[model samples]
Target: MSVLNTAEIMEILPHRHPFLLIDTVEELESGVRAVAKKAVSFHEPYFAGHFPGNPVMPGVLIIEALAQTGAVAILSQPEWKGKTAYFAGINHAKFKQKVVPGDVLTLETEIIKVKGPIGIGKATAYVDGKIACIAELTFAIG
Candidate 1:
């Protein structure tokens, strides 16, 4: 496991504070694939209003986490460093389960195809070995 701590991840991604979702990277293949983790906590800001009593991690945030994981893999390359990956689009996104506090979400993303500044990645988020969300993410390097 080539673990990247929060500091390393912050270096690769521009997100911060309540926006940066990924906690640690367990695997990375520079522009190829990556596996990361996000320890969901009840104290997360969104839980305060996402639902008053039954707080649930938003599905869109799961996709964002996946995208960030992919960015770590893509931007880690010497040629792509310092570049930002924008959310071009999302396809076939599906939510299989609700993610709540105390769940450690394992996020995996693999770059399936790329062309110039455009790229495609297949992403999935899992909790307790069960699939929580899956999607085909499209991004553009900026």
Candidate 2:
């Protein structure tokens, strides 16, 4: 189930609906790693313009969800509480499969390195135990 619900996640990360992709945080290790979930629904606004009938969740949003999961890991720390994590860079991003409506997207992000306000995370998104995307994300805490 969810360790942190959408409301609780909002307290740590300054993200709101439509943009706030993660529905719940299943696992979290302060400043180290996090695993979150997003239920892809046909009702999502992006499905309209993204495609008329063949609705597919954008690859960029998948990466953003991964970054948001990483932000939860970083922002949950006492020292970093209330801070915002901004994307500094995204490297080695690979999309392996399409994410569509009714899919349960599982996101995991592990903080691999941190120096001052900058951190790097190894992130992955999976659907039904198969990897959908993977990337190395760099973030700046401010």
Candidate 3:
């Protein structure tokens, strides 16, 4: 089911509960790409204030989830181990669908370019095969 569990993902990425959006990594290709999943639940903290009657998973968090997936891809490299990947930029982001509680997001990020400590990944988040969000994420490792 999971190529890398949450515990294993923690070893590669510096993130924790409430903020760690990804549940499990379904596929990994070292520094090239990664596919992860996140199960959205109404019990999430933000749901309390994100809109009383209507709960919607924020688009920003979806992007962050995508970024985390990309981080896993970049940080998995031996040279980048123990390094933190900071967001340099986010470009061409689009939210096509609303992700709500009970939706399981399938996030994928493919490293498209890398130069020195900076890299760019093409990311996409999907819910039940439908695109929820897409973006080009840039990261700077330090």
Candidate 4:
């Protein structure tokens, strides 16, 4: 149910393996909103250091996934093509549940405000329709 797969996402965002957290983009509205997915697997390299026995997907990575989702929305636009979205700040970030291997993270980011190269997005990450994390992310196009 994805509009853009990994191959397509790579073309828009300058990201690659080990760091590239998004798997598929399900919905996109140019610069308005986006929904993306990340399949968390036990084989992910981050699991080794995140925890020795009880592995939990890092909250920061979840936020990064949301950022990538936002990037997909912005970068898909005609005027923003090839531009990089840099993380400016994060506000009101809250983690409600722990995300583990075998979980599919559905990340959604909506543009809440925009002005020139700077903007803010409201983002949320969910697992099985349950909220995992929520935050307001600020970014700058470079």
Best by lDDT: 2
* lDDT (10s digit) by residue, model 3, range 35-73: 999999999999998888999999999999999999999
lDDT of 1: 0.96
lDDT of 1 by residue, 1-142 (tens): 4489999999999999989999999999988999999999999999999998999999999999999999998999988888999999999999999999999999999999999989999999999999999999999999
The Cα local distance difference test for each model comes to 0.96, 0.97, 0.96, 0.95
Per-prediction TM-score, please?
Answer: 0.98, 0.99, 0.99, 0.99
- Which stretches of candidate 3 lie above 4 Å from their native place? none
Q: Please identify which of the two predictions, 2 or 4, would achieve the higher lDDT against the true structure.
A: 2
Model 2: per-residue Cα lDDT over 35-67, one tens digit each: 999999999999998888899999999999999
lDDT of 2 at 1: 72
Badly placed stretches (over 4 Å) of model 1 are none
For candidate 2, the lDDT comes to 0.97
lDDT (Cα) of model 4: 0.95
lDDT of 4 by residue, 98-122 (tens): 9999999999999989999899999
Residue pair clashes in candidate 2: none
Q: Evaluate candidate 2 by giving its C-alpha RMSD to the native, one decimal.
A: 0.5
Off by over 4 Å in 4: none
Candidate 1 similarity to native, TM-score: 0.98
